[model samples]
Target: MDNKEYKEYTAADFLNDPDFLLWCLDPDKREDLFWSEFPANHPETFAEFRKAIQTVGSVRLNNFTLEEGEKAELYDSIMSDYRALCSRRRLLRRRLFALAAAAVVAAGVVVPALLGVFRPPTETDASPARASEIRLISGRQSEHIASESASIECAPSGEVRINGRKIASAKPARMNRLVVPEGKRADITLSDGSRVWINSGSVFTFPAAFGEGERRVSIEGELYIDVTPDPERPFIVHNALFDTRVLGTSFDVNAYCDSNRPASVVLVHGAVEITTGDGEQVQLESNDMFSLKAGNYTVVKVDPSQYVSWKDGLFTFSSGTLERVIAQIAAYYRVEIVCDPDVRELCCSGKLVLFDDLSDTLDVLSDILPINCRIEQRPDGTRAVCVTARTN
Candidate 1:
């Protein structure tokens, strides 16, 4: 069945699907991954899909028997509940607008207003500078670091230091945002003693001092973090796609919002619980890598060091495709890289130390592989790197 057809499925439709029955009866790893991630990809059908799963599980475990007449009645009941939920949501939306309107009248304000009640929560105010600079933003103040690579320290007292010099002092409850542009990186020590290595083209939003409950931070792009243990309060790393919760763990998260690449989390030590966009939860152990690509997800065991080595100025891979390797390099340097089709699938295994100079790194790469690299300047004032088969 076409995957898109599942979006419009009802509980009855799911219950009648042969593939769904197979998934419940004999679960395959690849099938399980697809089914588990289905609800996350199609959130509007989550309730119906969950109801179907529960019904199947109950019948299998409890040996529940239902006649055809009873089955029809159950499907009807499920549809009625779904309709009621939709109605309630519409009513709540109306009520919210009413409240907003009443507040505006009471304030004696006649201004036009656009209420974003249905908008998703995001760090919309934190805007990073250009790719050539690293910026730290707190409240109305923005500080730009002068170095290509930077060290940032956040004290428990809400004091921020950049490259060993005091930069800004924030309130305990205030939020601080750090932006690492392309071709640059930053190492940060949080107030809770946890350490985070921010990669190029990343934005990290965190509180100066964590509150009484959870130690939460949000990110866009990639990061390698070693969280400090606090049993009383869990640490949560939030992205647009999922949330990673851990008490104390070292993990690498590659969650760049690029459509061509998948978002992944690789655990180095300790354990973590991941909650996807549609509220599905997944648990991972040490060395477990969870990858979500195009709404489907898989969990696999891998050498965690291979994924986290970028923080150490190295690109470590084993039989990685040339196309994938070049993609990483392009993102790191914030340059456009195009690979000829013939050489794109070439496989190689080794380590490349990412040098500060792009030309130097390209030279090493050319020496290791049968490829030629050329840099060209575009009219838009950006550079592009083209890779092709070596003529030699």
Candidate 2:
């Protein structure tokens, strides 16, 4: 049977799963599943359990106005610079969207093949190629990647297309970043027929879509990739902070810019090369986890299972410092974490699923670690602090 015809993992599997496909695709639902325990595949899933919680807990409710306030602010900020131009004028100049007045739909010219198109998530302003168009729909968050003549097809091989042009093909890649939100993750099959799983609150961009050549893409945040076996492309990852070049492997990278030290790359299988700007370069084989600091590269042998924990649909932290654990949770949940030095230095290693509330996460972290965490209500009314009081 073709890959499309295959019975895949069901919706229920993804729903109860912290790392299940559900949480990766929808950011809004994460808060609902953060603390609930579901079946876990490995230590990695354990990590994501608490990670999901910490992420949601970090959402600062302070100073958050209603959606209407947000919309008004957006309009105020852009109206001056956008008052001109016919297309721009109609959309915002008349507040057409607010008035529920829109008629840009292309009737006859619209192609049937263009429906339900999926484009890559964009950072900040999605400045799409001048030739192509990717727009945000009103209700659903999918970037409506509409192109006139270009037809997009996912071959039996799971390869994707734009029109007839092959923007990404099977190939080894160097720098690939595919970003997924709390409720979304994308499956990208590499040229060598390897599959890369991008986790939520993470991005996986690879030359995996490359033609017959070396593959690469720079990434920010977390990702899980199963590299296709290719001697030539030797799938590679490039971050402004670090680099990982590998041949036929599966691995994960936690290399966001906010990371205190260098980003980390952990290999589950295959051979790889990791280079840190601090002049530290090393080759990693299976079961190796490497990280870069300002100028230092640290390599260690890991269970490999820990690195690919996100792959199992959960995140787990081994006996790590409280600060370190919190950092990972903060990024996943997209929240700000604050802890004093005394409590921050405390070490913790335990298993918990992602938490939906910061207060709840704080309670759990406090229960497991030698600290008491609480939210300090600010003058603005929304509690902003995840204060940790050292028990020691």
What's each prediction's TM-score? 0.66, 0.52
- Please provide the root mean square deviation of candidate 2 (C-alpha atoms, Å): 20.2
Q: How many residue pairs clash per model? A: 0, 55
Given candidate 1, what's the lDDT at residue 24? 66
RMSD of each: 25.1, 20.2
Could you tell me the lDDT of residue 169 within candidate 2? 39
Q: Per-residue alpha-carbon lDDT of model 2 for 1-392, expressed as tens digits?
A: 01221122232233333343233333235433542434242333454345544443333212323488878876884574355534553333223221111111111112232212112222332122111232222122233333211123334333455333445433232323333443233454545566665544554444423656666665655677777677866677777677788877788887655534456888887888877766567898888888776766788998865456544434455555556666655554454566565555454443443433445445545543456655556675433446455555
Among all windows of 10 consecutive residues in model 2, the one with the lowest summed lDDT is 98-107
Q: What would the TM-score be for candidate 1 when compared with the true structure?
A: 0.66
Distance from true position, residue 284, model 2, in Å? 1.4
lDDT of 1 by residue, 1-392 (tens): 43547655655456546567556655568768888888788898898798877755433111236799989986896576557656685443332322221111001112223211111112234333254688898999989876667778898889998866797699989988899877667889999999999987789999998888999998888899999999999999999899999999999988876666678999999999999998999999999999998788999999997799777556766667776678788877767787776566667555665656577567667655667989889897767788877887
Candidate number with greatest TM-score: 1
| Model 2, C-alpha of 175: deviation from truth (Å) | 11
Top lDDT model? 1
